[model samples]
Target: MKMKKLLISIVILVLLGIASIYIPIPGYMVITPGEMLNTKEMIQVDQGTKSKGDYYITSFEQGPANAISYLFSFTGIIKVEPMPPLDEQKMDVEKGKADLENSKLSAMTAAIRKAGKDVKYEHKGWEVLKDDTKYGIKKGDLLQAIDGISLKSSEEFFLPDLIKYYEKKKVGDTVTYQILRGEETLEVKTKLVEQNGQKIDDLNLRLSVKQKAEFQSPVKVNFKKLDLGGPSAGLMMTLDILDELLPEDLTKGNKIAGTGTISADGKVGIIGGENYKVLSTIDTGVKVFFCPKENAKLAQETVKKYDIKVKVVPVATLDEAVEYLRNMK
Candidate 1:
């Protein structure tokens, strides 16, 4: 009878463990340091733009976590964040990837233009790239406005700017969108909905860049990462493109890493997680890490806190980075 009780207890304990692992928790996500990926392994520039040396971009892995997994974080140094409901998170993830692809194209345009070559852009209307059945927004319709806000098409509207306006909006507000279908523009209004612990757009639409770039002499670039999202990789990607176009290598025989948002004007904008990136450099075989001028303080603090051997170089523009590398003895 004692052995029978012992076996039953073991079965019960196993079931309990399984339940703990599968149970979902509310309002939290797990964020951990991701790997330092080398850009050379993933980026392909046309032979006209190909250069020498390696560059790395850093990322932090983040996703939804269960109660048991969240609790396990206390045992180590993983970060837990109270995210928007699960459905909202899913939508944001989808939107983030689309925005990232647009940003990468913008980065390529900036890099090729910076090489003193002529670049051309084509205006592709906000063609229905993503179909949302709820708002009667069909595939192939061109988006023209949102809630009376006219989206500019100078370079075929910055898609993220339009998306940000909606994402920051109140959870239950109604939004009116103007879309063009079959040569006629129409007003379509939709309301956001919250249910089952999630709130998502009633007019769930996926939009992308309508602007395609053409460069004289054609220095085409392709950036591929299945799991990568966001525009943080912009600066390194721009730099990599520029490096390949020039005869000299900017990496200068040392491993380099950086994170920043790149603008079409060649400016390096601030990005999040500079502290975490600084910490990532320790024993990672990197000698120099470049960051935006705005993130210099945080990078310095993290470096000093951990006594990392890497040098933190702050640059404001692509030209500054190139000149610094050129003059380096």
Candidate 2:
């Protein structure tokens, strides 16, 4: 009887250990936006579309352990709000091919350099209202200041942080702006409205000033929704842009997978979560996995250790991925 009881206790302990991985331990459940925010300027912007502004996204950090914590964190919460599909709703991903093509590193760097010298704010893009009347603001338009204060790149200006600081103010509270338009310095006044919606305040309104802005005048935009797990979508975002810029289709309907952070210039950078992503692709029977040059070398080394039937297409930039995809087609 004693031996049988000991075996039962051991099995229970093993089960508990497995369960603990998913259940957030006492210390790890709550994650703040600050934890995920990248303090540096390493982020993508959509310069070619009506929707513009500065935004960044962190990759979804999930595993058996994270998966459980995510579940528990949202256990009793109910969402009545309807959201757009992953590709459509999330500004983090590229909107379409045009956005990717327009967001090239050269273009962005040029904008930033000019803004640094002559303007207080500069970003490749900004969003327009539903009526398409005007953009949030244009590039090269001097953003004299936010909330009646002068701004310099020296001041890390983020919309969410501003709102949080000013949240105590009422709806009619005025956020004064001094704008520079061309050779003329203009003054514009905007009033604060009550915050609505279910998402965090920081994510809802992303504001920035710009010297000037350029966007495609709205050609026929074909959009297909995709399920992208993280920032790795940057590479795919650029390739999709090249496809629109070029004469041919890159994704000829075959399942393609890969991960990397891509610049508008096409340089692919290392992204997070390679191993789990590789495993996901393998399990999903993906045909081609495109990885950044750095990640590709590591992934290749890993693939050789395990028998992976999927073809791994290694690319250094968005152009390379586009070329590979075209060849596959």
Candidate 3:
């Protein structure tokens, strides 16, 4: 009887262990190391050159935490955080897609301009910068018109006209906005409010609406649609495009990987999850990693913490990145 009782206890423990693997912890997310992708295979430029070495982009995996992952979060192997609201998560997914599209365009424009080619841009529409308004205007909505006035004109004149229209109205005024949300077109009504002791004007409008850039360049650049989203790959994508445009190889025959958002004017912006990204580079044979200047300290710390062999280089602009590669031995 004693032996039978011991066997039953062992069976119960095994069942509980198995159940833990599938059980999910609510309101929590887990982040883990993701893959390193070669940018050469992801981006293609027509009539572009090739590089002897490869440029890679690193990413992190994040999702709802399982029971095991929730427990492992205490050990520092993974990260666990409160999951964002479902509505916020949906909006983030949309914004991530938009950011990725803008990143590709910025990468192409920056590379082409760097190659001494002409590139011009027009403001397509206004992108919603905030969703705090009560007019049903959510973040990521594209505002095409205000009070029946189209904001799609020349970038120089659009803001002036928009400001002029708003100047005629006082606080507590009602205005209609024509916006595009995915495949649906909706008109939203919002009340004008005073900002900084002044009625809402172009300056106030600019706070909530950012002009979307549409580039026209002589050189055509296209990216293979991947399951990836977000602007963190912008810097690496720009470098890869430049490598294909210039005669000299940017990689210097060494494997390079990086993360940072690139602007149309070549500025590099900070990105999140630098520590996890550093871990992703381990065992990947990446010789150097470039990140935004702001993230450099944290990235270096992570590298040191993990004892990674990769060098962390911080850059403020696309030009700085290019210059660094040019001077690499």
Task: List ranges where model 3 is wrong by over 4 Å.
Answer: 1-9, 123-125, 128-133, 138-211
Q: For residues 77-162, could you state the per-residue lDDT of candidate 2 as single tens digits?
A: 21112233353333434332223333333233323332222222234323321221133445445555565545433121223335
RMSD of 3: 8.1
Rank ordering of all candidates by TM-score, starting from the highest: 3, 1, 2
lDDT of each: 0.70, 0.44, 0.79
Candidate 3: which pairs clash?
A: none
Best by lDDT: 3
RMSD of 1: 5.6
Estimate candidate 1's alpha-carbon lDDT, on a 0 to 1 scale: 0.70
lDDT of each residue in 1-329, candidate 1, tens digit only: 99999999999999999888767666677776678878887788878444455788877777677876677677443667677766656665776676567567767877888777777654444555556655666767776777766653523243344445756777778888788788898998777664423343466433432333343436677666746876678788887888877777777777778887776657676666777666677788887788988789988887886688988999977788778777765
Q: Residue by residue across 1-329, what tens digits does model 3's lDDT show?
A: 99999999999999999997877788888898788989888998899987989998988898988988877887665798888788667656766776677678778888888988889976677677777454566878887777888866533222434555766888778887778999898887767776434455322333344558767888888789867777799899999998899978888899999999886778887677888887899987899999988789989998988799999999988999888888888
Residue 81's lDDT in candidate 3 = 84
| Lowest lDDT 10-residue stretch of candidate 3 | 201-210
